[model samples]
Target chain A: AQSVTQLDSHVSVSEGTPVLLRCNYSSSYSPSLFWYVQHPNKGLQLLLKYTSAATLVKGINGFEAEFKKSETSFHLTKPSAHMSDAAEYFCVVSDRVLTGGGNKLTFGTGTQLKVEL
Target chain B: GAGVSQTPSNKVTEKGKYVELRCDPISGHTALYWYRQSLGQGPEFLIYFQGTGAADDSGLPNDRFFAVRPEGSVSTLKIQRTERGDSAVYLCASTPGGSRTQYTDTQYFGPGTRLTVL
Candidate 1:
């Protein structure tokens, strides 16, 4: 079993401020993690993924996440937040199978990000 | 021709009415998935199909929700006796099968079909 827990329900950040969204995971098997963004009235978009490769994964929109196995966390970070960054973000985990054969994604509840200008 | 497509855009129905949502995956893509997103919530997995067979359906909330891919291309999700709690935006995604490469694991999403049950 694999699951993800997003730490914040809502995060308010001023424009140009740093942004951080925390996520933790639980899995009996090797875990493949991902970050997805959903803008209002739009479909969910993939930001980044950690499939047990590089510890740090860079995603779209200047966002990145570091997978810390020891901490069981994959926390997203951005040097600066933009007004366009206002959206809901989700953390997802998948049971790692060889060659990404097992691709069932388990989603977190999601964190709403509000960036003030 | 470019991305996943879902029909009806929006649907409003009375309780106990039957509703169907359609999805047209990218051409030649062999994997398809369904998810439900309630207001302020992330997308929840409902079902997934590999080729013509459903690979996983454990996330389906109940038996009333069923999906089919007759020709392994266009699919339909049917909800029988819909209830108020069933209201949400239904999203469909498609990817390549077998490999977890960028084109396969990276799913292309549709705008979604918003369903409102009164």
Candidate 2:
């Protein structure tokens, strides 16, 4: 079984400041993590993913995340927050199924980021 | 290339009625998935299809929920006896298949269909 927990339900940050969204996951097998963002009335977009390659994964839109096995965390971070960054972000996890041979994503409750100008 | 697309961005149905949501995955994507997101909650997996067969359906909530990928490219989620509790955002995603390490492949998602049961 696998699951994800996003520590913060809501976070507010001013423009040009650092942004942080915390996420923790649990899995029986090797886990693959991802961060997805959804704008108002828009589709969910992939921000980044960690697939056991590099601990530090870089993604589009100046966002990145670090996978810490010891901590069981994959927190998203950005050096500077943009006005357009305000959205709902979800942290997801996937593991190889033993019988199905497919990957099913387990998502976190999500964190709503509010960027202030 | 075209991304995943879902038909009827918004759907409204009366209680006990039946509804079908359609999903068209990206060209050449062999794997398709269905998920549901309730208000203020994350998306929960419903089912997965590899080619024309259902690879995993363990996430389906009940017998009322069913999905199929007859052509292996287009998929549909059918709900029978829809209830108020069943109203939520139904999301569809797809990933490129044939990867030796399938877990590493990224899944592209669609805008989702908002089902409102009244």
Candidate 3:
């Protein structure tokens, strides 16, 4: 079984300040982690994914996340927040390919990022 | 190049009514998945298909929900005896399928169908 937890339900940040959205996950096997953003009335867009490669994974829109096995966390971060960054973000996890191909994803409750100008 | 597309952007039905949600995946993608997101929650897996066969369906809540991808492209999710608790955003996603890359391939998602069961 796999599950994810986004520590924050909502996060407010100034436009030029750093953005941090915390996520933690648990899985019986090695897991693949992902960050996805959803704009209002838009599709869920993939931001980044960590698949047991480099611990630091960079994604679109100046976003990135680091996988910490010791902490069971994959927290997303950005250097600066933009007004366009206001959206609901999800932290997702999946088991390794050995488990039913690992296509079934388990998602966190999500963090709503509010970037203030 | 097109992303995933879903039909009936909004659906409202009374209790016990049957509803079907449709999804059209990106061209050439061979994997399709169904997920449901309740208000204030992230999407939860429902089922997945590789080609025309359902590879995993353990996430389905119960027998009331069923999904099909007969031609390996277009898929539909059917809900029977809908209840208010069943109302939520039904999401569809797809990814390119290959034994080597299936685990790491990104899953592209559709805008979703908002189903409201009253």
Alpha-carbon lDDT, every model: 0.87, 0.93, 0.92
For residue A57, model 1's alpha carbon misses the true position, in angstroms, by 0.6
In model 3, pairs of residues that clash are none
> What DockQ do the predictions score, one after another?
0.38, 0.70, 0.65
Best by DockQ: 2
Candidate 1 CAPRI grade: acceptable
Q: Write the per-residue lDDT of candidate 2 for residues B1-118, one digit (tens) a residue.
A: 8899998899999999999999999999998999999999999888989899988998899999999999899999999999999999999999887667778778899999999999
Error of 1 at B45 (Å): 1.5
Question: Model 1 over residues B1-118: C-alpha lDDT tens digits?
Answer: 6888899899999999999999999999888889998887778778888878887777799999999998889999999999999999999988877664532177778989999999
Task: State how far residue A82 of model 1 sits from its true place (Å).
Answer: 1.1
State the lDDT at B30 in candidate 3: 85
iRMSD, model 2, in Å: 1.6
Please give the ranking of all candidate structures by lDDT, highest first, separated by commas: 2, 3, 1
> Of the candidates shown, which would achieve the greatest lDDT relative to the real structure?
2
Q: Chain A only: give the TM-score of model 3.
A: 0.95
TM-score of chain A of each: 0.93, 0.96, 0.95
> Each candidate's root-mean-square deviation in Å?
2.4, 1.0, 1.4
Cα lDDT tens digits for candidate 1, A1-117: 677889999999999999999999999977778898988778888999887788999999899999999999999999999999999999988774322243667789999999998
Model 3, residue A50: what's the lDDT? 97
